[model samples]
Target: MRSPLLGVWERLRQGSTSFLVDASLGALLAGWAVVDTLAEPALAPAACLPAAVASGSVALRTRAPMAMAVLASVGFLGYGLAPGTSTPLWSFVTILVVAFAVGAQLRGRRRWAAMSVLLLVTYAVQILDAHRSPGELTWGEVFLTPAVLVLGPALAGWLLQRARRQAVDLRRLAAELETERGRYAAAAAEAERSRIARELHDVISHSVSVMVVQAGAAEQLLPPGSPAREQIRAVRNTGKEALAELRRQLGLLGTGGDPAPLPGLDDLPQLARATGATLTSEGVPAGDTSPGLGLTAYRVVQEALTNASRYAAGASVRIRVVHRGDELELDVANDAGRPADQRGSGRGLAGMRERVELYGGSLDAGPREGGWRVHAWLPRRSGSPR
Candidate 1:
C-alpha cells in the first residue's frame, strides 16, 4: 500500500524548508509565463507585481501562515485588476499552502475558523474577477473550489495526527516490556538464592547434629577407669567425620569445578545413626525417588535431628521416611524434656516450613503429647503433594 516515491517526497519535505521555497519558485515561473503570454505591454508590470509579492510571502509561511495567506489573497485581487492577467490563478496555490500550514500548526477552533475564512475569501475574489456574465458566479463553483483547498490540508493533518499517536503507543509498549523483563529477572534471582540457602542449611545442620550427639555421648560415658577409652575414640572419629563432611559441603561452592556429591535418601540411615536417632524406612525402594525429592527428604530429616539435639538433647528421637504411592513423607519426633531456657526462638521450624513449601510440599511442626514433632509430605511433581 506504500509508494516509494511518496516516501521519498515526505522525507524531502521533512528534511528541508523546501515546500515554501518550491511554492515561491512556482509562483515566479507562472508570473513570467503570464507576462509573456497573456499580459499586454501597459498592464504587464501590474500583472507581474502581485505574483512577485505572493512569491516573497512564502518565506513567512511557517512563522506567520495566516499573514502569508492574507498577502496571497491580496495579490490575487491586485493581479485581477490588471488587464488580460492570468498570473492570479497561480497565487491561489500559495494561498492553499499557507492555509494548510496554519491549520496544521495552530490548535483548537481558532485554526479551523482562520482556514475557513482564507478559503472563502480566495474563492470569492477569484470568482468575481474571472467571471464575465452576471450569473457566472454559481453556488456550485463557489462551494467546490474552496472545499477542495480546505479538505486537502485537513486530510494530511489527520493522517499526521494518527501517525503521531501510533508512535506514542509503540513507545509505551516497549517500556512495559522492559519492566516485565526486569521483574522476571528479579524473581529468578530470588528463587536461586532460596535454593542455595536451603542447601547450606541442610549440609551444616547435618554435620553439627552429628558433632553434638557424639560430644554428648563422650561426655556421658567417659567416667574414670570404667572402659572410657573406646568412647573417647568414637568421639574423636565422629568429630573428624563431621569436619570432613563440612569441608566437602563448602567445596561444592567452588567457582572452577564440578559440584560435590549431594546427600540423598541413601545417606539417611547414616544421618540417623550419627544423630543417635532411631530411623525407620518403608514403602517404595530408594531408587524410585527422584534426585530432588531425595535431597529434600534428607534435608528435612537433617533439620529435624539438629533441632532435636539442640533443644531436646537427652530425649529419644524417632525418624521415619515413607514413599507411599505417588508421594514421599517424612516425620521426626523427640521428647521435649528441655527447660524453658533451652527452647529455640522457632526460626528453624519456620525455615523448615519454608523449605518444604518451595518444592510444592506441606510441613507441620509443633509440640505433640509432651514431645516435639515435625512432619512433611513432598510431591513427585509440582502440581500435587502427599
Candidate 2:
C-alpha cells in the first residue's frame, strides 16, 4: 500500500519533461506572491491573484509551451500597465520561467521565431510595468532590465537543451557499443566450438585412426586364438567408433552451434580424475538446466582444472560444485600455487569469464587463503540473472 504523498510523488515522476523543476519554480513564485501581497497596506492576498494564475502557467510550462507563453505574456499586459497596487512578484518570475521554457521547448529556426515573439511581448510587459512605476529604478535599470527579463532566461534554456542533446547522443553510443560487445561474445563462443571440432579432427581422430591401424598390425604379429589378440581387436573396434563419433560432432560444431553441450557437470568426475583434483558436490542438480549454461559451467571448470594441472602440477587442487535452486556455484582452488603463477597471460580465464557473463552470471578468479581460486556463479537457465 502506498501513502497518499507517495502516490502523488509517483504521479509527478511520470509527469512531463521538466515537471519537477517547473513545479518547484511555480511553488517558489506562488510563495513569493503571498509574501508580496502581505506587505501591502491592507495585507490583501487578492492583489496577487493574477500572479498566482501566471505562476500556474509556469508550472505547466513544457506541457504546452507555445500556448502557455502566449497566455502568460499577452495575457499579462493589463496587469503590467495597471496603476493601482504593484504587480505581484510571481508574475515577473513566471514570465522569465515561461520565456525559458519556450526557448528550450522549440528547436532550430522555429525556436528563434517563437522566442522572438515571446521576447517582444514579455519585453513590452516589462517596459510598461517599468514606465508605470519607475520607483527608485535607475536609467541602467530601464535599459538592462528587459534583457535580463528576456534574453538571460532564454539563453540559459538554449544551453540546457544543447547539453541534454549531447547526453542523449552519448547514451545512444553506449547502447550501440554494448550491443556490439554482445555480438562479439557470441562470435567468440562459436569460434571456440569450431576450434574444438578442428582439434578433434586433426589430433584425436587421426590418433585414433593410427591406433586402429597399429592394433591390426599387432594382432597379425600375434598367434591365432591368443588372449592378447582378442584385446587388441576390441581396441581397434573402439577406436573406429570414436572416430565416427568425432565426425558426427564436427557436423554440429562446424555449423555455428554454441559449445555443443560438451562435457557438462555429469562428466566433471572423470575430468577431476584426469586432472588429479578432488571433486565434491552439494544439493540436487536441477533437471531443467539450459544447455548453454551447463556447457559454460563445464568450460569454466575445465579451464580451471587445466590451469591447476599446468601451474600447480603437484599442488593439491579441489573442485566444488553447489546447486542453489536457481543457480550453480563452482569453486576450483589450489592450495600451493601462487595466484600470479596460476593466472599468467589470463587469455583462457578471460574467455571463460566472457562466456559465463554472456549468460548473465559472474566469474571471479584471484588469490585466496594462501592459494589461487577460480569462482563462478552461473544461472541454471540460459541468460537468467543470478
Candidate closest to the true structure, highest lDDT: 2
lDDT of each: 0.68, 0.74
Task: Please provide, for model 1 over 1-386, each residue's C-alpha lDDT reduced to its tens digit, 9 standing for 90 to 100.
Answer: 99999999888679467666756655665565355534455466656666666555656555566666666666666765666544244555666665666666555675676666667666766576546334755667667776777667755754665677789999999999999999999888766655564555455555466666777677666676666666766776777777666556545544223334578889998998897899888887645555556787787889888888887777899998887677788999999756434667677778778767877888998899989999998876542122
Error of 2 at 78 (Å): 2.9
How much RMSD separates candidate 2 from the native structure? 15.7
Under the 3 Å rule for N, CA and C atoms, how many clashes does model 1 have? 0
Candidate 2 per-residue lDDT over residues 154-258, each given as its tens digit = 888989999999999999999999999999999999887786675446545545777899999999999999999999999999999997887778786775433
* TM-score to native of every candidate shown: 0.46, 0.54
Give residue 253's error in model 2 in angstroms.
Answer: 2.8
Candidate 1, residue 25: Cα displacement in angstroms equals 6.5
lDDT of 1: 0.68
